[model samples]
Target: MNVFEGSAGYYGRYRPGLPPEAVALLAGAGSPSSRPRRLLDLGTGTGLAVKALLDRFDDIIALDTDVEMLAIAETDLRWRLPAGVRLSLCHGAAEEFLPPPGWRADLVTICRVFRWLDRPAVLARLNQHVAPDGAVAVLADRSLWTATNPWQQAVRSVVQDFLGPQRRAGSGVFPATPEPFGQTLRASAFSDVTESFVPVRRAWSADGVLGYLYSTSFAAPHLFGDRRDHFEAAVRQVLGCFSDTDTFIEDNTFVIHLGRRPA
Candidate 1:
């Protein structure tokens, strides 16, 4: 079973969008040129990054392995895309996707799902299609599981009790990235690598937290089998103990790593 098999609804409904500052940085990186502007978004879960960039690129290609995820993205983008923008939604993996002949992209973005790809192979593939002045932006951010707040800790404890101590994904445990993302990019064909960080703070309700957990592969609602409601109730009860206002604040750091291929 693929980790994201049945979680497309939760993912599309609960995942947060990229911050304004991060979007601005990506826009600023573009240079004035006569070449056709294209954007390729890999691991584009429910089209978060692609939607954020619809106004910036003339052509957008969004790729994801899950058919259901792409279907949701297609539905959302049909109304969200700006007038005159062309959108292409491809169902494929980052390591295996190939652009049409003569297709080159002005920008490529991989959001939270980069860890699941073969880094070197995908980077090599991007290098073949990235325009001279174009860049590849890799977005990395911590999930709610990394939160240190008391309410978050309590919720995590309840999940651990039901799902066991390991972080479950698909048929295997999630593996950590073997090396720093920056180091991996530096070793690739790209050059002029740089990193930027944006600090973000958001408030979440207990229900919002539950929705967010269900959106992830490790904690989807179906994982609880017939005890889904019971698990949610337990999480709600634990969160209620830590908050009087029914809201918990999350402070997150979003990191963007930009690497450019020589012109």
Candidate 2:
């Protein structure tokens, strides 16, 4: 299966275990009443963040490159959308999606999206969409399940080796560090650059973790190929060794960045 196909179920099913810092950063963008009458959600995979934004903004535009992802989002939104909320989904990259003339948004949000973007181009395009006084916020989660724990160090090493090539080529998406990413934001015309880190923990049953692994398009080949059964069995054993309980915890860090266009 392709990346989006194999991975859809995982990201599509997993709920956003948003950290408080992320919430605060979003709130800092503007209060609901003060929020831009117009808003945009860039890389709105499955519309999780879009749903949250809708609570504050009555007019919204969401863009995603994946058509299937948008389809899933549309289904979810149909059920929970509030009255007066309007959403338009654009099937294209953030840098390419054009709003109407004199279009300007009060707020622009890119949650867990930048890792997949061309940093420079996206920053420029995002700048263009925001009203002079508007704010743009970007959020990303750094997966540290393997890196932080001494027991998981070996697992981290193995996973790193697996993802090494993709990381080098910037193909894996998402940055492992925030320094360089923050630098790009700083170099832009945006002001009041503030970033906060929030720690999150997710509990997963054995099958759930297995499903998550299989859902990764990059790791699917390793998890579901000739060694499929073997790999799953090994995962069960490794997780079992790590936990005395039926579930395991994924400890991660989410970083939120907030900046504003010049007024």
Candidate 3:
């Protein structure tokens, strides 16, 4: 069963892509100069990160658990692919993905989808597949639930009033604080782990916030069931109180965690 069943449209439209600086950091960690460079993007939601680094790799395979997401991601990247670069999309979860026989990935990237996966198991499996000198880079950013801005807090209150105090993520509840990504990489088979941060500012209109909420696992439209309309009305009311124009700002940081094969 697809957990993010109806979210493809909202996700493709509202989820922000990685900033160029973060993309550059990831690109630098890859083996671009090596011939037949390969990129394996696990959980490639909308192919956002892969789109940024398209030209850096010769062969790319994007994997995702949601079929609809793969469709959107494919449409986004297929036309932009450079000559001699190959792109393939597979529907599978990271924990179940196995590298093709004797084939190794020059770089393996896991973006926002890491928290939904079995962290230790995924890293352990990547040990056998990532190129000798290549890296496994995982990225994540703050969600509105963690934002500190006044308007954001108000919005959260409205969501909680509708969905209860606990956060719902698909079939399970979201962790109040999941273990840090960097710490997980450090304990894996890979070595020379390092962490970096990219500060980002996000601007949102009331409508934009509504669309983004629908795109998230915890606040997906399905979670609201028949009350989605009522929830949206409450969110807009709260947003209106905070800003007559319905504009909001979020100061967020993208955290990148990189681990590499042992030399």
Candidate 4:
């Protein structure tokens, strides 16, 4: 069950883009002096990170398993790239994607979607494709469902009432990451791992929250089935109870883990 099959519209429209500071941090990691840099972005749903770093890379390969997600990403990046910046959108999973013969990337980035992949295998694949001096950056942040705000709690509770207490991924429940992402990276061929944190504050309207919910696998509109309208109304009511202006703030801590293959 591919949860992102038909949710690309919501994902492209609602999911937050990478913060400017985070983008700068990634760009500043290292730059090759001889030629333009190349980037490979795995699990690039809707291309948020790709869009942010397009200007810095000479060529970019954005890969994802969902066709709809790649379609939306293509549309989003169609006219946004700078002159001479080549873009290739591939449809595939991270575990099995193979770069072109002799291709190597200066940077490989996985954002928000890394937890769903086979970590060790993906890292191994990246190690083969990344330049010796290049790095792999995994970006992740706490979910809105885990926020401690009253409104966030109420909204999550309503979702639980409609769905269940556990998080849903397609037809199955999502499992917690087997171990800390850093630990997994360290255990892989990428042994030089470092981390950085960026605190982000955002305000969301009720509609924004609904859009965000629709973008995620766990509280998607399809989960409600025939009760989708009821679920929306209930969520609106819960949010309204706390937000007079129908806007709620989310304080998130975004983390980036950089992994480099030992020289």
Candidate 5:
């Protein structure tokens, strides 16, 4: 659930490759000249989202619980950020941090990491930090649409063949659909709660597909242990059927739910 620690090295590897909704949500949140004076990126991971925020905010603070992830985030900022942008990297569970009394922020965003917690609780927590008349965006990708791709049969065959009950019992790739998730936010005191979906198609080669899966926690045990070769072989067998000219299309659906903090 700690995406910062989970997706460390792979962070931002797919840059310029994010879902369209992600870009749109960022835009809807506002631009540099008009962006909120203060921005909070919860569960920031390696800070890619926050990096974008930095372009807007004169001061930005990103917090994550994983030390390893924050370490990399700090290094990335030093190496990649332009001068004059104030950045602070805090290490701790996001829920543990409280905005100072009477403190409210212009923007509060959690991208790709909010679904890991109990939805209602997290929404309530995020709502507490938003400035009145301010906005919040919770960004997520629904990976289950991969089932619509031509290769779904093959990939499911292998996963069902090897991972069996685990696949069913463990968390499925996508979290809540757009509607229910938005309702959770509405219930937590956000007004004008609206959900928008963006469809993004990511095309990757056979090896790229396997690499993406191997990067996941579900696949890591098999990817790093005795079954590593076996798992790779199964993935390759399914993906290798594609021609070099052919690309595997993964339907990356991002749901953006926005609400205004009541005045």
Candidate 6:
């Protein structure tokens, strides 16, 4: 089964975005031209990141491989954007995105989705669309599976107890360790690679945690099969042991790796 199948709704509701200051930092990393700034957001997910960037870019192309996810973003942003601002939501792979003639992306964001792309091919593609002084930001925040909070651990334990140990992602399994995305950026054509971390603390209630579980590729609803309700119950039971009211404070450090080509 596709990991993202039936996961779009949950993703839009539960996935947290970068903090406002971090969004400002990401927007500032690029040098866009006057009048209309263009932003190419790859793996736009629910368009949450694009929504955060509405004021940052006048012309935005939010692209995603998942048609369902892109549709949701299109629906949400269509109403939120001011009149006259250009918003084009494309449903396709990042490499397939062809902007209008003379359209150059001032900043391109690959948020929490490096696992889904061919790193070298994407870099090569960016060289064609991105401006000479443009910036590319690879962004991500820890998910429940990777989070070390006591409540998060309990949730993972419950998921493993139901899904049987190996973490499933799409048709295969996720790596036991984290991928080195920064190394890939450093080796790409975009030079001046730098890393930054933005700390954002959030509190998750039982409902929030439960909703987030279904958003992940590893713990997606289909992975539970007919036992999804049972899995939720088990997760709730385990979570109760962690907090009385079933809420947990999670301190997340959002990561940003910015790379830019020489002007």
**Candidate with maximal lDDT:** 4
Question: What range of 10 consecutive residues in model 5 has the weakest lDDT sum?
Answer: 168-177
Q: What is the TM-score of each candidate against the true structure?
A: 0.95, 0.82, 0.94, 0.97, 0.79, 0.95
Cα error, residue 9 of model 6, in Å, equals 0.7
Q: Which residue pairs in candidate 1 collide?
A: none
Q: Write the per-residue lDDT of candidate 1 for residues 36-76, one digit (tens) a residue.
A: 57889999989999888888888889999999999999999
Sorted on lDDT, best first, the list reads: 4, 3, 1, 6, 2, 5
Stretches of candidate 5 off by over 4 Å are 1-7, 11-17, 30-36, 100-103, 144-147, 168-179, 221-224
lDDT of 6 by residue, 133-216 (tens): 888999888888888887788889898898878888855798556457788887887877889998889988888988888888
Candidate 3 residue lDDT tens string, 1-263: 35675788999999888988898898888676777898999999889888988988888888998888899998988999999998989998788888778778888999978887898999888888878878899988888887788888898888889888898776567756668888888889866788899999888998899988888877888888999889999999889887766678888898888888666
- If both were scored by TM-score, which would come out higher, candidate 3 or candidate 4? 4
Residue lDDT tens for model 2, 37-122: 77888988788777765676777888998787888888888677688777887889887868878777777788766766787787
**Model 3, CA-based lDDT:** 0.85
lDDT of 1 at 125: 83
Q: Which is the better candidate, 3 or 5, if ranked by lDDT?
A: 3
Clashing pairs in 5: none
Candidate 2 lDDT (Cα, 0 to 1): 0.67
Q: Measured by TM-score, how close is model 6 to the native structure?
A: 0.95
Could you give candidate 5's per-residue lDDT for residues 177-233 as a string of tens digits? Answer: 334557767777776676878878777776665555544444433323576678768
Top candidate (TM-score): 4
Model 4, span 128-247: residue lDDT tens: 888888888988887767777778889889988989999887667877756878888899877889999999999999999999888888876677899999999999999989879887
How accurate locally, in lDDT, is each candidate? 0.85, 0.67, 0.85, 0.86, 0.62, 0.83
